[model samples]
Target: MTEVRVGDLAQGFLFRRQAVQLRTELSARGQELSTGRAADLTDRLSGDTARLAALDREVALAATLRRNQAQAANRSAAMQAALGRVQSATEPLATTLRSAAAGGLAGELAAAGSAARGAFEDTVGALNQSTAGRSLFAGAATTGPALAGADAMLDTLRAEIGAETEAAGVAQIVEDWFAPGGGFDSSGYLGADSPASPVPLGGGDQAALDIRADAPALRQVLAASALATLAADAALNLPEDTVRALFDTAAEGLGSAGPQLIGLRADLGAEEARIERAGARIEASAGGARRARASLIEVDGYEAATRMEALSQKLESLYAVTARLSRLTLLETIR
Candidate 1:
C-alpha cells in the first residue's frame, strides 16, 4: 500500500468540520420530523419554488384581509355604540320638550331648553367618538373629532339665529345650517367632505361604514336641539308662547328622528354580521392555502423521524471521536 500520512492539524480540522455539518443536519432533520415539512424546499422540490411562492402570497393576503375585517368590525361596533348614545340622548329630550310644550309653565319650558342643550352636548360627544385614536364619524378625515365641541357648534348656530325668535325663522335657520352645503358641513362639522371608503372583507363583500357627523338623521336631532336652545336663550328674552312653540317644534322634529336612528343602528348590525361571515370564509381561505403549501413541502413523518435519528447517532459518534482525539497529545499523535 502506498504510504499515506495525514497531519494531526489537518485531521483535527476535518473532524471538526464534519462534526459541525452533522450537528447542522441533525437540527434540520429534527425540525422536519417535528413539523413534517422539509427544511430545504429548494433541495426537496428540485429547485421549483413558484408554487410555494404563490402559496406564500396567498397566506399573506389572507392574513391582510383578516386584519381588514377586524378593523372594520371594531370601527362599525364603535359607530354603533355612538349612534346608540345619540338615540338614547335624543329620545329623552323629545319627551322632555313635549311634556313642557303640552301643559307646562315657562320655567318648565326653559328647563326643557337646558335639557336640550345637555342632549345636544351628548349627541355631539357621541358623534365625536374615536376608536384607536381615530375619529369614528369623521369620514375620511379620521385624525380629528367628527364635529366641533358642543359649545362651538352651538355658537355657530347662535350666530345664524342672530336675534331671531320666531318659531319658523329659527326652524328654517337650523334646517339651513345643518342642510347640505351649510354651516354644519362648513363649520360645526369638521370631518372630511367625502365619506370613508368601504372596507374589503373578502369574498367580494365590503363593510361600508359611511355614517358621518353630517348624516341626515344626526342633523335632524341637532337641529331640534338648536331650535330649542335658541328659543330659551335668556339673551333673546322671548315670550313664553314663542318659546313653547319652539319647544314643540324641537320635540316633534326629534320624535320623527327615532326611527331613522334605529335604522342606522340596524344597518351597522348588518355590516357586523357580514364581517363575521367574511371572517369564516377568510379562515377557510387561509386554511386551504396552508394545506396546499403543506402538500408541496411535507415529508413522510416516518422517513423524517428515521433520518433525524440517524443524524443524531452520527453526531454523537462524531462528538465521541472528537473528544477522544482531543485527549491524544501532540507527542502521542507524532509517535
Candidate 2:
C-alpha cells in the first residue's frame, strides 16, 4: 500500500473545499448579475413611456380647449360692449321722451328723435360687427359680413316700416318695429324669423356664428332698437307730447333689457373662471403623471454602485483562494 502523505491529503482537501467555495460564490454572483428584477424594471419603464404619451395627448387637448375658451370669452366681451353703447344711446332718448310727454318744445323733440335714429343705426351696425376679420353673429359663416349688404338690410327695414304704417298707424308701426322678430335673425341676416335656421354669413347657407340662438338680452336689444327707429320717424308727424310718449316707450324697452345683459355677462364671467380652474387641474394632473412615470423608469445610481462593488470583492476573494491552492505542494510542505 502506498503511504498517505499528510501534506498530500491536506493539500487535496484544502484545494477541493476552496474549489467548492469558489463555485458557490461564482454561482451566487452569477445569480446576482442575472437578476430578472432588471427586466421587470425595463418593462415598467416601457409602461411609463406609454402613460407619458397619453398624458402628453391630454395636455395638448387641454391647450386647445383653453384657446377655444379664450375666443368665446372675447366674443362675449364684445357683445357686452355693444350692449353698453345701446344703453348709453337709450338713456338720453328716454329723458327727452319724458320731457316731451310733459309738453316741451317741438324743435327740441325732433332733434331728440333725430339723435335716437342715429343711435339706432349705430346699434344695428354694432350687431353686424366683426372681430379678427370674422363676423361675430355669422354663425359658422366666418368669411365676411353676416348680411348681403348694409343698404339691402336698410331697405328691408324700411319695407317692414312701410307695411306697419299701412296696417295700423304710426303707433302700431312703432309697436311692430319693437316686435320680437325685429332685427336680423339669429344667423345675423335679415328675415331670419326662425331661430333654428339662422342666415348664413357671406351669402352662403353655412351657419358660422356661435352666439346662442335664444340669447334674451341680444334679442330684446334688437327689438328695442327697431322700435326706437320707428318711434323717431313717427315723431315727425306727431305733436311734441305724443312723440315724447313713443320715445319714452322705446327707451323703456331698451332699459328693460339692460339687467338681462348684466346677468348674461355674469354668466360668461363664471364660465371663464371654470375654464381657468379646469386648466390648472389639467396641468397638475400632467405633472403628477410625469413624476410617477419617472419613478417607475429611473434607476438608483447609488444602489447599483454598491452592488457592483460587493460583486467585485467576492470575485477577487475567490481568485486569491484559487491562487493559494495552486501553489500548495507536498514536497515544499515536507521540508
Candidate 3:
C-alpha cells in the first residue's frame, strides 16, 4: 500500500491538466451560447461530415430554385399583359374594317385609315416592349427590339407591292413579302432565330419565359394590318373594289387570328399557374431544409449555460488547490 502525496510533481501535473481542460470547455460553451452554433462541429457531430455536407447542399439548391421561380413568374405575367395589349389594339380594327367594306362610305374609310395607322404603330410598339431591360418578344434576343419601326415595316411591304395593277398581283406580292424569305422576313424582323430558353421552376421543372414577336399568330396580325394600311393609303390610288377586297381580306384574317392569339395568351396563363405552384412548394421545402440544417449544427442554449456554470466552479476549485500546493514546503509537509 502507498500513501498519496498532496504537493508532489504528479499532483501539480494533474491540477494543471484539469485547469487547461476547464478553460477550453468554458470557451467552447461561451461561444455556443452567444452564436447559437456548435463551437466544435467535428466533435459535436461525432465526425459525421458527409451528412452535414449533404444537408448544406440541399439548402443551397432550394434557395437557388426559389429565385429562379420568381423570375420566371414575373416574365410570364409581363408576356401576358403584352399579348393582351396587342390583342386589344388589333381586335377592334377588324370590326372597323368590316364596317368600311360594307358601307364604302368616305367618312368610314377615312376613320378606317386613321385607325389602321394607329393600330400599326401600337402593334409595332407592343412587339418592341421590354420588361426589366429584357425584350419580351425578341425570342432569344433579350437585349434588343423584336421588330423594326412601324414606318420601316410598312415601307418595305409597300415597295414589294409597288405598281401592281390587279388584286391578284397585289395579293401575291403581299404573300411573297410576308412569307418566309421575303422582304419582311429579310429586313423587318430584328429578333434572334432561337427563342429564349425556359426557366427552371424546381425538381427539374421548366417554364417558357418568352413569346417571340415573330410567332405565327403575331405575324398574321402584322400582315393583315399591313394589307389594311395599303388599302387606306392615299398615295396608292387603289380602285374601289380593290380597296374593298383588301379590307375584306384583312377583316377575315383578323377574325381568324383572334382565336389563335387567345390561345397564345392561354398558354402563358398556364405557365403562370405552374410557376406559382412551384414557388409555393420550393418555399416550403426551403423552410424544411433550413430547419434541418439548424438542428444538425446548432447547440441547445439551456445545456450550454448549465455546462458553463459547472465548468466555472471546477476551475475555481482547481485554482485554489494549485495555489495551496505551490505554497507548501518540504519541512511543513514532513511535519
Candidate 4:
C-alpha cells in the first residue's frame, strides 16, 4: 500500500490543478498570438500578393493595348491630314477645269492641265506620307515608299499631254499601275477589294483611312480630264466646239469626285472620336483594378500592434503563474 502524507496530498493536488490551468491559459495565449500574427501578416499578405500580382498583369496588358491603339491613332491621324491636303488641292483643280471648259479659252485649258499636273503630284506625295518613319500607305510593306519613284511617274504623265496616242498611253499606264492586282495595288490608300477599292479612313468593317489612290470617282474625273486635254491639243486640233465638249465632260467628272472626298473626311473624324473613348475606358478600368489590388494586400498596422500588445500581456501573466507554481513546497502548504 502506498502511504500518502496529507500535506503531500494537498500540495500535489494543488500543483496538478495549477499546471492544468497554466497549460490552458498558455494554449489560449498561443492561439491568440498565432491568430493575431496571421491576420496581421500572413492572411493579408497572401490575399494581397495574389491580387497585386493579378493587377500588375492587367496593367501590363492595358499598357500594351494602349500602345497599339496609340500607334493606330497616330497612323490614322496622319492619313487623315494627307487626305485633307489632297482634297483641298483637288478642289481648285476641279474648279479650274470647269471654268476652262465653260469659257473656250485655250489659255484656260492649258492652265487646267498645269493645275491637274500639280494636283496629281501633290496626291502622289500624300500617298507616300509617313508616320513615325513608317510609310502609312505601304500596307504590310512599310519599310519603303509605297510606290517607288512615284514623283517620276506623275511627271511622265504631265509631259504626256498634247497627243492623243501619248495621252492614251499615259492613261493606260495609270490604269495598269493602280489596277486591283497590280504592283501599286497595295500602294493605294485602301486595302485590296474585288469590285472597287474602298477608301481607307473609316472604322467598323472598313479601313480607318478612307483615302484611295484608285477610287473610281477620282479615276473617272482624272481620266476624263486627261482625255479631253489630249483631244483638244492633238487630233481634234483645239477646235472651239470640241474643246467645249471635252471641258464639260471633265468638269462633270471632277464634281462627282468632290462629294466622295467630303464623305471620307467625315468618316475619319468619327473614328478618331471612337478611339479616344476606347482609350479613356481602358485607363479607367486600370485605375479600378489597381485600387482593388491595394485593398487586398495592404495590412492595418494599428490593428496588428494592438493585438500584439494584448497577447504580450496575457503571456506575461501566464509566465508569472507558472513561476509561482514551480516554486511551491509541501512545507509551505502544510503551514
Better by lDDT, candidate 3 or 1: 1
* Per-candidate TM-score against the hidden true structure: 0.84, 0.56, 0.84, 0.59
| Cα error, candidate 4, residue 66 (Å) | 1.5
Q: What is the lDDT of residue 55 in candidate 4?
A: 84
Q: How does candidate 3 fare on TM-score?
A: 0.84
Selected candidate, larger TM-score, 1 vs 4: 1
lDDT of 3 by residue, 1-335 (tens): 43456557687788888899999999999999999999999987899978889889988998899888988877888888888888999999999999998976877887787787888788889889887898989988899999999998777777777887576677677766777677776688898888898898778889886678878898888888888888878878788778878888888888998999999999899889999999999999989888988998999999999999999998998898889877777677899
Query: CA RMSD for every model?
Result: 4.6, 11.9, 4.3, 10.3
lDDT of each: 0.87, 0.55, 0.85, 0.58
What lDDT score is found at residue 167 in candidate 2? 20
User: Which lDDT tens digits does candidate 2 get at residues 1-335?
Assistant: 54677996897687668667756654544553555224344365655566656756765654555455455546556655655665676556666556654565766666766666666666566656776665655556555554444344445555655633332255565444334564455223542322223322121212212453236676566555555454556423444445566666666766787788677656656545654555465457557755665565454555545665675676578667767756757676587
Local accuracy of candidate 4 as per-residue lDDT tens digits, 30-68: 554455333333454754466567787987767766675
- In candidate 1, the residue pairs with backbone N, CA or C atoms under 3 Å apart (3 or more residues apart, or in different chains) clash, namely none
Q: In candidate 2, where is summed lDDT lowest over 10 consecutive residues?
A: 199-208
